[model samples]
Target chain A: MNPEESLKFSYYPGCSVATTAAESNHSLMQVCRLLGLDLQELEDWNCCGSSSAYSVDPELGFNLSARNLSLAPGDRPLLVMCPRCLHHLRHTHLEMQQDPRKRRAQERRWGRPISPDLEIVHFLEALIRFGLDRLKKGAARNLNGLKFVPYYGCTLFRPPALRRQKYYQAEVENILTALGGVAVTRTYNQRCCGSFLSAVKPELVTSLVNDIIGSAVAAGADCLVTTCAMCQLNLEVRCTAAKRLPIFHFSEILALALGAKDCQGWFIRHLVNPRPLLKDRGLLGPPRLGQVP
Target chain B: MNSQPMPAKTTEVINISELDHHFATEVDRRSQADLKRCYQCRTCGNGCPFVEAMDYPPYGVIRLVQFGMRQKALECATIWVCVSCHTCSSQCPNSIDIAAIMDTLRSMALEERAVIGNKEILAFHLEVLHSIERYGRTHKLGIMLRHKLLTGQWFKDVDVGLRMLTKRKLDLVASKVRAMDEINRLFLPYWRVKPR
Candidate 1:
């Protein structure tokens, strides 16, 4: 596939994106259609093990993620929507290539000769690779003056040297600007939101997410946009009402600007819905009075 | 028997340089992180979310490893408490991966049969693994329920759990993955390697 002019790639919608952040999945679907991006989800893919595997069993984490890569078709680079999933897949890819023992284990499990040739790219990477000029020209509605803090919660950019080449450090900011949204620079963008440990230690997550969201709110962001599903979840479930920062998936903002009309269900799914802010800004129409169900 | 070695008297001139010499090597072998590369710069702890909660901060963990304080580094609640954020790894001037070290410590604790300080968090990890073992995915509610039952934290997160359920975030039932047996096979090595 041509790297520059191509939009088609196999999509791996990580676990959280399907359940907790289903809105992200909905918005991503709409955005892909509007932008002419072809995202075919990998068939029969399993979990990437996330932080759970890394924190508990290193071996399980590697094998579980490698299993997914093994299942991916080599024809197209696997485009992942979640940063955690992207990191795990990519990290395991690196490990399996470098470690002879792990490489042997991976090849044996899959019953074939494996290759690190499986390219794993994050949504941000794909969008950035998709070209910003096209995004600006293709936007159906301008998100001008809509201040957004691009909250990159680890994964994609962290462990910097490993991710340095593949990821553009300012890619999220670039995407927001291209879509006509003002990216808040002063806000704490690249920080960890305690990720999945939020389930076990909500208090710790609350403090961490509070600081990240507070920075955005203080910087006058209308909403904090994130590419990570876990970051959105942590901010939604942990942050206090006083924080008043509605967490949004980057797909939601782009999908809206691309004129996604259906998916009121997606908007309502947010713990603190972004519609009121969008409606107030004239970026989105008023909520329709329709059936509750 | 206590796992720790006897501490030398403060009044005596203690030549402890040779003591715990193998600590750094053992941690290095497991973590694939060179503990000696750490220069006591607390950059990792500065960015750590759990530093206040940890007995020894990120740099302190490496320092402990450097001094061969295995009991100090491995038996504490910090390993369980760490979110594996990799903030330390990213910021480390030496490129020392603190997250990997934390995982290594957790594995060491489990292997050594050390008394874990944070049973609640431990229970949560075990329950999640158990759920994955059965369904081949981390069944969130099932893991939550099992964790609550195991830890007796029934009242914990009930409000949030209820809210998620009402919001339809929780998929109460899901079809088991067809290759669950394959996942089970993966766990076989984990079960057999334990000396106990």
Candidate 2:
């Protein structure tokens, strides 16, 4: 694929980004638009059988994910933002590839061709493949040496089933650094953020989230930029530490650096308001009268 | 005879006849993880973030499975506590997919109607699935409300819930897929209609 040409992808926002992390979705669209990446939202995409479906019933999980695959247009690669969604979609795709009978059965069920060769790529991977040159050329506002821990959460690249596939360990650092952000490595960057347990067992999640935030604060980082929207929510909502750092969806920072004007809308949604930190670093202007300070 | 009494026995003896010898094979087949390859190095347990909350560590659960302790393995809290973060599997020297095995055990436990090790977590998952079944997408507010109602923990996490609502993070209305029939059919095979 040509770096200069606009890349088209079928975007799968997943459930979290669609609802709870709407700001992330907004910022993601902003970033993609600035980069000239044309994202067509996957038509009528359903939930990817989140951790819940897979936990109680493996067959339900498989079928749930298979339906999303059936909906993907064979012409373009499916671009997913959430790591868990990416994992399930890609894992289901791999399973279908290995078992032709299952693939055919699902295809027949959906009355759509489940493409054997459809490429499932994460947004980060898509950026690496086609946006690096665009990022360097189209960067409007530098990151102002903003120090952030590139928190990939746990599911981004750690799953054993997808081990042999693409490894995205340093991709966040690579992209953010190119935009002038300083990457903080001396922290618990890849720690699990307690996932859905944040909902049921808030105490447990609070302790775990505190540990993660404490590590980041001790490491002297300004904020955490995460690839997963779920991690962003968990970290923001579950932390009970004395001092808290703002958690950013990776696309928010990317969109900010690209000179997105609607940043207030995005920053306002954060539990730990990032406006003050952004202002302190000269990344954002002083708030207007009556605006969130 | 010596006057000193024998120390109280701390270990429980397992009756070999009760062990399900095919349990390991069933898990292996479902999870696609080679349980036989696991030598109990304890790496998975050591790396698990939530191991401290579990009744048995990841390795201990694997040991139970290896020993065909089906009832013990199925009812363990480790499976429910695990969020499938894959930290254990990634750190395993033998490359055992310990998270996958945990997922399989959780499913088996649900299927066999074993006592749920963590009912609250299971309740949360059920609410999430229920939300998906209704709207074809998860409604965070709905899931939380239903979960709270089911667990009868209305006051717990109320502050965070309200905070999320104030921040407009939790959508009141869920986004739905246009193809509801397509999604509902997928859930038909396994989802038993439970009174909400």
Candidate 3:
């Protein structure tokens, strides 16, 4: 995937990626260059309405996500990283594919014809598809002995019946394997993180934070890695409110193995410092380690 | 000991007729797509962690709205309590988006200055957004201070302060984003007009 060549993906970096998780976006670009995967940022991409719109009006939610799905080029698979976005788009795609009446209702609501040909694939699957073994070969450094809990948090491989059949269910351990890291087995891997509760009712978020991080800590995980930005924000923010746990977007960890910098260059600033744990693990790379007075 | 007999006023306490006009108007203004389908199975109710602490349960809140009990529904603790987790929506057999409706309800209540209950929580919510408006992202300290100042609870949560201090969590020093001016400029209107 040459940065200059035409190896492109129809990328949908959701709202959070653009602003809050800028480092993940930057690292994604860096890894894309390293892997020679060209990403064409979809023009005029709108909010997938996240979980909000979907809850407001199911038809409206489907149409909004489908409208974005409809924007992808006919040839390329639509690439999305956020699991919430993936779940919503996948739900819409599956629903539209399975039912003509639902599709017609959505199309009528959207006031435009919708495309049925688009296939949505998450960035994790894309990386796996591109070959994790090859990715390991490209790693500038190994994540040796860095134990992490691969927190999937429900959305990625949820409602197992609907998700399993779609081949959406995956153990992130193999990707962890690619980085030469051990994925600690933790039951919180699929637990609910009390997602949107952080904004509306943070006290409940406190209990969820306790459980999620407590599970990872109990599992002896040195860190937490996830695919969704909302999950990342909730875990990181609530972790601050509760305890200090290092939670990273999966790509940030991947970027670390690629040796971009220790902790993805000040993105750690947004998080409560996880340096103490990283120090305990002796995994602190140059930049993060350098910041120690 | 014998329990005191209830006063006649207690039985006459259903002054809910006053709420009908407002409830009817609001329902007319908002979409009622699946509002009537709720059977109070409380699937959404059980999914909501906030329901236990709510003055009205999630299903009861919907029932209130459906019955045009606007004042009681708006005044219900569930409106302030819902965290917008979508667990309820996900579990809903009718696929009714109870959580988003909660958001719409909160916004409506704030717009109408109808926050008779959970004013502190509502103020905290607004203060959180105001902090974001000023800093582009939350600086926990700023939000806490602003919420405290607004709610007149500056010294009330001393135990919280002590814990944060012991944890080395409170940065007495200010932390800010570079675009503070632009961000604050963008959000000033919202803060100014937002319900106190």
**Candidate 3, B95-185: lDDT as tens digits:** 7767546755665665676755676666665565554444444445666677767767656656544554544444555444453443333
TM-score of each: 0.90, 0.94, 0.62
As a whole number from 0 to 100, the lDDT of residue A49 in candidate 2 is 91
TM-score of 2: 0.94
Candidate number that wins on lDDT, 2 or 3: 2
Q: Per-residue lDDT of A164-216 in model 3, one digit per residue for the tens?
A: 43544454678776666888875476666766556445666767777778878
**Candidate 3, after superposition: displacement of residue B36 in Å?**
13
Identify the runs in model 2 with alpha carbons over 4 angstroms from their true place. Answer: A2-6, A285-293, B1-9, B189-196
Hey, what RMSD does candidate 2 come out at?
A: 5.7
- Best candidate according to DockQ: 2
lDDT of 3 at A205: 73
Q: Write the per-residue lDDT of candidate 2 for residues B86-139, one digit (tens) a residue.
A: 988888888989989999899899889999988888888888899889999888
Worst 10 residues of 2 chain A by lDDT: A284-293
Runs of candidate 3 with Cα error greater than 4 angstroms are A1-8, A54-63, A94-114, A159-167, A240-243, A261-268, A275-293, B1-49, B53-196
Query: Lowest-lDDT window of 10 residues in candidate 1 chain A?
Result: A284-293
Docking class of 3: incorrect
The best candidate by lDDT is 2
**Candidate 1 per-residue lDDT over residues A1-293, each given as its tens digit:** 57644677888887788766788998999988988888888776677886777777877878888878877777677889888788788888887767868877777877765566767787777787778787776676777578988888777677542644477577777777776678887877888887767777788777877888888888888888888888887888888648577788888887877778875778787777777887777776632333111
Instruction: Please rank every candidate by lDDT, starting with the best.
Output: 2, 1, 3
